[model samples]
Target: MRRFNLKEFRSERNLTQKQLIAKTGIPNVTITQIENGHKSLSKELRKRIFDAFQVDERLYVA
Candidate 1:
């Protein structure tokens, strides 16, 4: 199954969910949902997250 590596990436970056939300301009609930595998991000949000992490979007998708 495909999975998102949000939590892993965030940990590697030493960022908390709140910090990631602020940096990515994503809602806290959305970040939580994504981390918990309850929701997937929209393309735009994914791009924002990738930019915030300074990594390619593929890093988060599996």
Candidate 2:
């Protein structure tokens, strides 16, 4: 299965990391780590991201 690459998704939205944090309230460090492959998106944070984008969270799950 393909992992949900947050960086790609964020790029598609034309958003900067800081902008995403501001929009999702998920924190800059968390977004940075996730994007850098140094961290995984927790279930709660995953839900927040998908919900913020108004999409199905499952589609973005690893």
Candidate 3:
């Protein structure tokens, strides 16, 4: 599986962490931890994030 580049993804969409929190309903601290490599993504979080991005998950996986 390919690693998701959260920062790059947000940058490509012109999103601030707060904006992503608004869109994904993920907590700011959780997002911060994920970005800093201090936390791993749960499946539910991945689903929420991809849904917020409106992209097919298959595009991100091998």
**Winning candidate number (TM-score):** 3
Off by over 4 Å in 3: none
Ranked candidates, highest TM-score first: 3, 2, 1
Please tell me which model should have the higher TM-score, number 1 or number 2.
2
- Residues 1-62 of candidate 1 have per-residue lDDT tens digits of 23557787789789988898889889998889988989976788878887776776564444
Clashing pairs in 1: none
The lDDT leader among the candidates is: 3
What residue runs in model 1 are displaced by over 4 Å at the alpha carbon? Answer: 1-4, 58-62
What would you estimate as the lDDT of candidate 1?
A: 0.78
How far residue 33's Cα lies from its native spot in candidate 2, in Å, is: 0.8
* Per-residue alpha-carbon lDDT of candidate 2 for residues 1-62, written as tens digits (9 for 90 to 100): 35778899899999999889987998888899989989988878878888898977656445
* Every model's TM-score: 0.75, 0.84, 0.88
Candidate 3, residues 36-58, lDDT tens digits: the string is: 88988788988899997788877
Rank all candidate structures by their lDDT, best first, as comma-separated numbers.
3, 2, 1
- The true-structure Cα RMSD of candidate 3 reads 1.8
Cα deviation of 2, candidate 2, in Å: 4.8
Clashes of each: 0, 0, 0
The true-versus-predicted C-alpha distance at residue 50 of model 3, in Å, is 0.9
- Model 3: lDDT of residue 27: 96
